[model samples]
Target: MGEKQPNERLTSWFVRSGWSKGELARQVNRRARQTGAHHVSTDTSRVRRWLDGEQPREPIPKILSELFSERFGSVVTVEDLGLRAVVPVTGAGEVDLPWSGAQTVQLISEYSRSDLMLNRRGFLGTSLALTAGSALIEPMQRWLAPGPSGTPTPILTAANGGEPHTGRLSGPELALLEQTTVMFRQWDAHNGGGLRRKAVVGQLHEVTDLLQETYPQETTRRLFRLTAELAHLAGWMSYDVGMHPSAQKYYVLALHAAKEAGDRPFGALILSDMSRQMIHLNRGEDALELIHLAQYGSRDTASPRTAALLYSMEARAYANLGEVNKCHRAARLAEDTFSDVRTGETEPDWITFFSEAELNAENAHSYRDLAYHSSRSPLYASMAAPVMERAVDLFRVDETHRRSYAFNLIGMASVHLLQEEPEAAAGLAHQAVDIAGKVRSERLNTRIRKTTDAALRRYPSVAEVQHLSDRITTALPEYAAAG
Candidate 1:
């Protein structure tokens, strides 16, 4: 693209708005007052320089853009003014998020606005790097210590027609938010990001807006928790369709909201979700670091089921590194912990997704990863096959859990291929693709791709195997295009 010239657009806009330099300055002051800025200037001289192609500084361009937009009765942006926005620099080592309630909310609000922008430049890709590494050390340490006393609390309350109101979020309102979370989660599991991304982002916007209202302290905390879960779900939905960096940002948003709410467990869950993103992107060491961070964040308070889930994540990371012994150790720890899982213990709604069956499927894949390191040791593949078989047996016949069922079959097919059992592998691959057709998960598509690769490698000459491979290869473009 050609570089756009400055002042040309701005001058044209001024002409279109038919405003004199003094009028433009007055407009800036008017906008500043509307937004409650006390330090804004009414400088006709500055306005003249802008019209003559001298670029204005930070926030002035933003304010000016809005003023012209209002006057012209159309959308206008700082970019339309041909001025560069002095965006805050976000680097890998910076923890940019502040450890204050209002600050966290402000961060989320700004992020949501940017994310919803169709032409948003920074979020074009997704991330797994926590970005807050060196920057977050102080905040993490503070979170570990008791929350400071006398911190200003943000009020949460009710609103109608998007206007402020004087009341706390009622029990029914809280229940409604909870139900919304549940419904979106169910749909996300089945159809994945392709179908649910926009809906999830809308949920984030609604919750974020509601969070700006006034409520009692307890209700405020609950609202924070609910918003945190919604942000986490938005992150996962983004990850499912391959919006990696944006996914990481939403995960961080959830982490901040959870921490702000004093919910350490959910914070830990957000870290694990980020770890999952890293592992899928093939950053094994980074994934392991995130999992360890999760464990540390949760510590002794985590339920056995949650701990097992964390350990399973660790196994997946170690498997990504092709570290067989470490993978088995974590896998064994995960399995052993789940053995003591009680039926009636309180658990987060998200934990409902994991159990013995999920653990088995996770372990089976870990072994398959090990098998990849040493094709000579078909024993790894042999071990994976039966575990996957049991996982498939344990899976319920529900389309909502379709990804789970399809992935277990895909894992089984991989093991069979490793064992040089072409016919069985082909049959299973075909079965997985059929199930995948019912879902919108790129992660599932990834497993299907794995199945296709195994089939081609083990029995490229077989008609059934070739047909399945061709089918998978053909469908992936459509999934990518779905983005």
Candidate 2:
């Protein structure tokens, strides 16, 4: 037998984690049970053995990776823990999601199935690296490529080899699906993604299954569009809760569905959404490419509102990269395009949500980013709060936009901090916390902590700051525990 050697990599991470061996085992066991894995029997001895150079098993490596990732507030992987790579159990990790044609059905089915498994089991963490913008070129080219017939793919007829199945979709059934999507979007906007991501994924699965059955050309296009919307929702929800890898997968699936439906405008929206995720992950360059792709691809088909939203996202990406001039330029374009919104124009249901208020909120975020990253901190910071205030006021008028309202409150509070008004910031942060209790979003919770920490750093002696800090701990105990 080979001489036993210590697992230096695992040992280093374990020591850095500052957790007792038993605590590590307990957390892993607790997470396993929480995910319905009652059979896992990890204990301190097993952890000790792993440190002493044993590769414990299949799931321990995965579980440990997740636990450490959560503990450290960043991505940790099995390879980083020096564990042997095992074959993916469900092949979900190995599945190739091609971005074209009838093959899109297979892509949707497989990806949605994998997503459901993760939602149900919570057994695995996202190990897949996000697809970079440069890597998107081939797929983007394929998407923009015109068909040989210069038309949409002809929907398959039963005689022409549509799958013979019982779950055929009717017009009413399709309409119901659309209505359900609207309801889901409202719910997502009001609360957050963590609460109902599974439901969205489940609906995507059902939609994918229905796609396997026969339908007319119009029905097929509608089904594909619905699939795209649902997948995009699922993606956005995943992103909301900090599931970047899963979010990336869902977003790509949405893009594929959009292309399959021959819906360029929707595809642009999906691309824009993906760029937002990349921005959140601090990949601003990649985000810029994505926003540009969305802009160029949908230039003709996108309405004024959609164009404005895309430009707003571009400004956000530029702000993330500290490009103050580019950010302002894009923001102005967004504003100008927004001004062109005339009454009674036909707009997508999704795009209709990006009203003036939403545009203001987004631009505020861009300025906030610039304030953090540029020399004109006072200039950008001063602009952020008022725009955010306008957004918050508008958002408050709609009960469905509580999440947006809460987020804007945080943004305004952050600007207040930059303005040296700790008391005002504390008050706004307190309102955000109150809203946080009503909404269930991890992203919102994280923002509360960050803003809270900033206030504490600046005005720890202030009564309101001290009180707000205490209130945040009570309102967001899960985050407090993680911290």
Candidate 3:
């Protein structure tokens, strides 16, 4: 029964080309139509059956062959694609996780490809249990080692000598990618993950193509850094959309790519990001461990801004863990580091986004969390309320940051609810959800839910609170996942 089994080769190729089962079917059907033959009405089920070892009838195979060949930049025979009858099983997926540089490269490629088809049911979500702590332990160890310098093996040149191949991405294209990353960050801040998820993922797919082709060593290193950065962005976008398991996978891929690029700093940032994801998932211990990993990895030469960001994340973890004193100490350290910053310093471009506004917004969230969960002091919310107001004021003129404004408004509204001021809370909730339409984010949706729940619980009989909740339900159906 196992002789002719599910073909791993075929599945990998299809995923590498970024085709969903449905997409592959659609492409084949479209190709058949272009051939002027009787239109083949193929469904994703047919494609799934094919993946499960059912050979297609006649010209369908030819059509698929051409489609994959064109997209993958090579000749893809039906046999090569593992579509023929009695094709051997190439083992069940990539069963082993990677460790070395070569293995890491292979791992990232597999990961991006799997992303198109990874079963959502298998993701860890809010739990740290899937691979347990083992999944992260090895990578963290490698990240702590001094960043690798030049390899001893002669830096291999492309076939046509040291020049960039005509088919490869030019310097301008790479520069444009950096520019696009900036735009993506801004878009994510204002609009949310759903808006740019596909765009960043698409860029990542194209970059995989670039990485596959031969390029200069210097170019390759820079390209790896870019790939790492983009992958982190893609991961962040995924996390923003509530795809936590998938987000963790992408972050791991980004961390590996950064290490390969000799970019220890970006690796630290990605680790810190993973920690934040853990905290969001309510896995506080995991968050603290990951933050300490970041600090350990970057301690040798972390810039003030990077240090500040790291410390801020540490504060977040401590607050989540209900360690009020640890949280306060970390937050104060972050503030002190920020205060010491001056001009003429070379900082990672990504950290510049973490200004006083960003820190205050983060601190506001920490204070709010501490108030609600651990300290249970009305004082925490009172402190958080003004800081959140300050964040709103900062984000107001920066139209590209309306989502941040929305977040701060949500926090501020919660603070008012804590103070038993229902009208003030309802008014802010109304304003926050008004902008929620423009920012299609699951995180923001969670905030909406939180706001509604808090408002209702604080003053259940109040008409304005009821009306605001109804408006939220009506306006942002998709974020709410309402049919």
Candidate 4:
């Protein structure tokens, strides 16, 4: 095909297919309505603009492509809609559009309007391909390498004549960011963070680059803090994926960014997350140190609810260290702090979801933890069930928190098994395993495996427990390997 003007190409395609501009516009509008989108006017002038190489925003182009595909009984792409120059063909013979700043903003806005309507659901195709590429151990190894000796590259200054820099993000943009964060968090919680870690990490890299290159210093600082939060999330995903060292590096980087942002509250939250990771690694001493750091760092600045959360974390550390008295003291402090928490107070965005019941649930966990470490077998059996039940009730609204609830149930089951209540323990263990099957959480699955393995070992004659254990083993190969 000879090089031709975009308008000429569009018009030629329409002519050869015997479609008038008006008809195409009508078809596009009809499809948009079907998707519950605002119907664009199918006037002659609008159609003329499309034939004149004007690329209508998002859904319009997508709708046109779909309509054309249906009309011609062949694949129609953005290129065939007079945008071949803007969107080039990939090596895989698919039309690939560059997701630049403007495009990202637009896509995000569209997704906010109706995520269900977006053609590329779950993960973007490009993101999926990049994740597959990064699955090779070497690439991840490189990302985990130490920083270079030379000074880091300076961030690029925004262009003088470029778009006006807004000191603060618009409400819509902020909402979009928050929504995206929640969606990814839920996905991470239910599923092993492995599946979407690379994609979210890539997004953090992109957003960080854009913010640094385009924003003013003050805006850049705030943006960097948000970027750091995303980085922390990426690290959490890495930790969930068994890439502990890589996760540590990301956490360190996030800590540096948070400190630079002068956001003590956020820094404390990151520290709390770091402590949790340490606990997972069985570094109880290290976890305790980090939890103390978090409590101290946010002592003056944190809200009552946040303070309660920090204290709860400290209690967990104390429990892990087998300090029952200290654990009880911290748990009481958490409860007292939570009692003073007021509704509608300007709390940090991170802990806004915590309520009185949630605090009680934390106390429950503290009791359960204390029971676990104390080897008070009957106490463990008694407290574990009620605490886990309360936690599961509170977390029912959040799919991501469901795994934690499930893990707690598994713990309760183990406690029952220790008391020689094999029948009761087997029933609870089976329930935990069943819930674990629906979620993508490796952590929850691992917890189930451990509890069920113990139960099966102790009560070899329990057929139901044996079958549940076998099913869990088959569903999660990693759990079997780790076992």
Best by TM-score: 2
Pick the winner on lDDT between candidates 1 and 4. Answer: 1
Candidate 2, poorest ten consecutive residues by summed lDDT: 87-96
Give the clashing pairs for model 1. Answer: 126-244, 126-245, 126-246, 127-244, 127-245, 156-213, 156-214, 156-215, 157-213, 157-214
**Candidate 3 total steric clashes:** 0
Off by over 4 Å in 1: 1-90, 93-95, 119-146, 149-168, 396-398, 476-483
Worst 10 residues of 3 by lDDT: 85-94
Q: What's model 1's overall lDDT?
A: 0.72
User: Local error of candidate 2 at 361, Å?
Assistant: 0.5
Q: Please, what are the lDDT tens digits per residue for candidate 3 over residues 285-321? A: 8789888988988888778888888999999899898
For candidate 1, lDDT tens digit of each residue in 290-338?
8888898798778888888899999989989988889999999999999
- Candidates ranked by lDDT: 2, 1, 3, 4
Report backbone clashes per prediction.
Answer: 10, 0, 0, 3
In order of TM-score, best first, we have: 2, 1, 3, 4
Q: Compose the digit string of candidate 2's lDDT tens values, residues 143-215.
A: 6666666755544444135555454567887899999999999899887776677888899999988887666
lDDT per residue (tens digit) for residues 1-483 in model 4? 653334654565577567876777777777777777874656668878767666677667656655654555433444434553122111311112221323323333332222113432321211111111112212222222223343221331332236576434554674576567667776766655655775676566555545534455555555656666776777677566444444554565565556545566777777777677666656667678777777776778888888888888888778777788898899889989888988677754556646654565666666766676776846754765676566656666655466655665676676677567888777877777666665555556556766777778888888877777667645554231221
Q: In angstroms, how far off is 231's CA in candidate 1?
A: 0.6
Give me the candidate number with maximum lDDT: 2
TM-score of each: 0.73, 0.80, 0.73, 0.61
lDDT of each prediction vs. the true structure? 0.72, 0.79, 0.71, 0.59
